[model samples]
Target chain A: MRLWRWIVCLMPGLLSAGEWSGYAELQGRYFPQDAAYENQSDHLISLAFQPEYYQRWDKGNQSLLVVPFFRWDSEDKERTHADIRELIWTYAGNRWEAQAGIGKVFWGVTEALHLVDTINQTDLVENPDGEQKLGQPLIKLSLERDWGILDFYTLIGFRERTFPGEEGRLRSHPPVDQDHAEYESDREERHLDFALRWSHYIGDWDIGLAHFNGTSRDPLFIPRISNRGEIKLMPYYEQMRQTSLDLQATKGDWLWKLEAIHRSIDSGSYNAATGGFEYTLVGIADTDMDLGLLGEYLYDDRGDEATTPFQNDIFVGFRLTANDVDGSELLAGVIKDMDESSWMFNLEASRRIGSDWKTSAQIRLWSDIAEQDPLYSMRRDDYAELTLTRFF
Target chain B: MKLSLILATLLLTPAVTLAMTAEERGLEIAKEVDSRDTGFHDFKASMTMLLKNRHGEESLRDMRNQTLEVEGDGDKTLVVFDEPRDVKGTALLSFSHKVGDDDQWLYLPALKRVKRIASRNKSGPFMGSEFAYEDISSQEVEKYTYKFIEESEHDGIASYLVERYPVDPNSGYTRQQMWVDKARYIPIKIDYYDRKNVLLKTLVFRGYQQYLDQYWRADEMFMENHQTGKSTLLTWKQYDFRSGLTDADFNKNSLKRAR
Candidate 1:
């Protein structure tokens, strides 16, 4: 393929003029509960590699970037995959800039729910947290002016969200069928998506307004009978429109943040919002450590039967930063459903090992999740994970 | 009675007229330092940071900084991390003021979000460096109250020793002692004491270079934390002044586009 030739020809140039950098990580997760499936294992190991290449010219006014990521999980077949994280060429003028290629975009302010972030497809197989993403191809333009900055996006080919395999520990039972995917759009994945945002800062407040219209990245799974006479959840992508507002106010040690959105899908239209504040206590106990207290309220209009979670929920958490040489920090939080006793608790900690190495660990727990809850399937998937990474 | 009254008046008047209050001398020196650093307009420079741990392990980070001087107030600055693949695309925008709360924003590349960091007390370290957030900011004359300590000599350079107290209640340090060079009106060394009045760190500036025939910049700055046995060294290069940078170049949207 011509792509292979391009890769071969670009190798030498990338080593000399362009910068090549990446990281490799080995991770392991252990579960306290017994294996839930025949092929499931209590212990799992995964190795991941991410390599990036970047080249810039004209005093950094123009550039090209390429980043490829791969992960190989020993226990779960679906977890082993490869993706192009970013391969964008960018240009910047005096007052405007443009980029065309595959990349990722994120928008949100809340810590618990990220109600506004919807650019890239979620790589659920990589982690249940959904912070990782598969890059999307798009053309982006941004204009900077006196009052604010305006950004425009033209999204092209869409990437479908990935799911954990049957053997994966954090997955729904019986698995969701990926091959029988259907889309409301006649063109399926070829459907175009568009988005725009205007952001500004006034005094101590930073605000952003954004809108998106496209094939919904979040699919609706319908229980269907397959050709093999087995029941499976069929993935259905629908057309949807969403508008969001994100706001944050920083005064002294307090950060007040809010993110709200209104989404309209063929199923119906709904409004959801999450707002919170974080108060930080710096130099606590006469040391350089900082402790941040966070509280947020989540609301949704659809109520109990709503497909979206976080209907009448509250999140409380704390983030502790050591301010050490390694940049060590720990964050712990719990989101409690007000309608029920269901709660999801998570803990994350990371620190540097040496000059080029870093280590991190995470723990997640779900308790009293009702059958109607969106996270009901993951109720028993409590896990503790550890990863050591090396960068070049 | 008349003789005694005249004697007392003469003694008191001489003492009052001869003795300069520490506050007066302190303000005079601070004014001099500010005067020498004025009218820079803007600047761009590259820096290499060396971080060392208690065990003597070392790490390096490369970065570029651009600062636009705002008249009548503080300066607007931007720092872009260039090395260390993890933080390459990371940029920090700061709008510093002499009084009141300064504004700061951090752009996280991996998350693709510009987070407005809480800037109540800037006592936190700047990216795990020995320099705290407050230390990296441009020093304005109004940020601290100063008192002349004494004159001292370091490395054979005549210097004026002064002690400054932070005006904000949120400062992590109780006081700081600075040694300013007599010839250049520049701080050559400083000692920071913690809230407990304990010696915390000492910073030294070396390799002073003058640019634009009027501006003075240091080629290297070293900060040593006495309590933690850690240190950070910043080596600056390519000092370019009057780069035609404007206020629009330091906005939040340009944070993501920073190279």
Candidate 2:
């Protein structure tokens, strides 16, 4: 009953619009490995529910948008969680408008590896791993003119960490004494990040550009320390600077997309008790580059997501789509016993069923080019997965 | 062997006959609707377009246009913009055939060039409305497989509910359900779908009038979105047909010559 009440409160925005709308989905998967231990197969089931509510007043000049979401994974001990995905209050006047509160701000168009879907789950790039380490409270502002649109935002009071001691204890290992010591005194960290984005359309092309700077939650730490000498501190002091460029073009049935991203990171210095080595990870000491391409062929059909029939018309007969999904080739030159370069490729093809359901087969390959070199050879693995998705 | 052959023929005859009857009825209705659409030689109408976003805010614009064309089989239409000078003198030519594919061209005075609009994009929104390029294109009986669903009344007019499935794979709409007036065969209502077979939108027609005795035109059309709380209203005026339009006027080279 307590869980139900919490879910209801978290979803006030969903019913506020006085309309009832929601969707539920379930997915299952199987894995196989060459080695018995590595090849051990497992099954996972997950459910995601979203409810949306909205109200518009003053002839749309002022409005409220709310969406609350919930999820449960059978594989994760049947743990259930709820979150307010979007809660935004908007005010629009003539040429300028502003929206504040917690909501998703998607900045990039790259489908597979979005540099800007950074609202939540910074560590889990493709799937949610039950960790709420991502997402920050932010304030957003925008200005719209006849020519284009400009947007700005700042995120504050951000902290996420993982302690090594708790994980070690969970695995029946010794807990870190330093982590337990830190937990006795409540230690809190804060961060502030800012970004500017611009978007405009010219003829058949839509273009976007953005730049952002801020501290990224330490990817290697946990935020809380347990009383049992478990240290949960996400490595902080690491900062990142990022820039992106995007372009999309549509002609006839063909839609083309191209995007590029450049990121520089400064990994802060930390004390290593195990090795008794004091290390300072420089900021912007390493650079990462990403390039992506996407293409889709749209067929003519009634523009609805439902009530369309299964037909083999030219537009609906068959469709082919391919993306470099997450083709990020990372190059780290001689840094802390880590010098390697890796790349990934993914491709898919699907057949349209009416307008709501589609079945697709996908193949993925991952490889490390410097695997043979002693300086950089710890990265080489390939996996493939096929999925049939239905959209409404 | 002889007995089995005879039995096989006897069993297949009824099933084939039933299938043919349904298809034949659908084709007949399509032809009837197409024929009734004939006769407007030329037309001009003043219109106002209203757009309402999800927030319930409304944006209104005025539009005036003139259309000249014929009906049935192969027909050519010339559309001229009168208001919104930015789009004024922009001429749209549609060459529709009874079978096979249709051709379209747009002449932009600013660009001083005639551009061919591809038919593959016929499923997309037309002028950002629920109506797709395929919906506005000429409807030839052979291009679809139709099924008569039922009989109903709309705005006091007796109508037949018909389902039309596109034969062209490139069409955006997999299937469309239409309400055609019994007397005039003009589509009074239509439901559209996307490739995923989801209900995307609906269009309602009102205020029907006869032009040049044989042509029936709907003065008002309202399109509403199912997912997004958006709607578009189009009011057409001055619909004309057959102002001595010839093949020369529809030629790619003649796009600039169109006045």
Best by lDDT: 1
Candidate 1, residues A1-392, lDDT tens digits: the string is 99999678545545558877878999999888876555777878999999888897666677788999999998998999999999997877788888899988888888998889988999989988889999999999999887788989999978888998778888775678867789999999999999999988898999999999998988988888878876778889999999999999987889999999999999989999999999999878877799999999999998996776699999999999998767789999999999987999999999877557889999999899987888877777899999999988
The local lDDT score (0 to 100) that residue A151 gets in candidate 1 is 89
Model 1: lDDT of residue A359: 92
State which docking tier applies to candidate 2: incorrect
lDDT of 1 at B138: 81
Instruction: Give candidate 1's error at residue B90 in angstroms.
Output: 2.5
**i-RMS, every candidate?**
1.7, 19.5
lDDT score, residue A15, model 2? 45
Error of 1 at A227 (Å): 2.6
TM-score of each: 0.92, 0.44
What TM-score should be assigned to candidate 1?
0.92
Scored against the true structure, residue A361 in model 2 reaches a CA lDDT of 43
Q: Give per-residue CA lDDT, model 2, range B92-154, as digits (tens).
A: 777666665565667764334344443454554554444556776666677788888777887
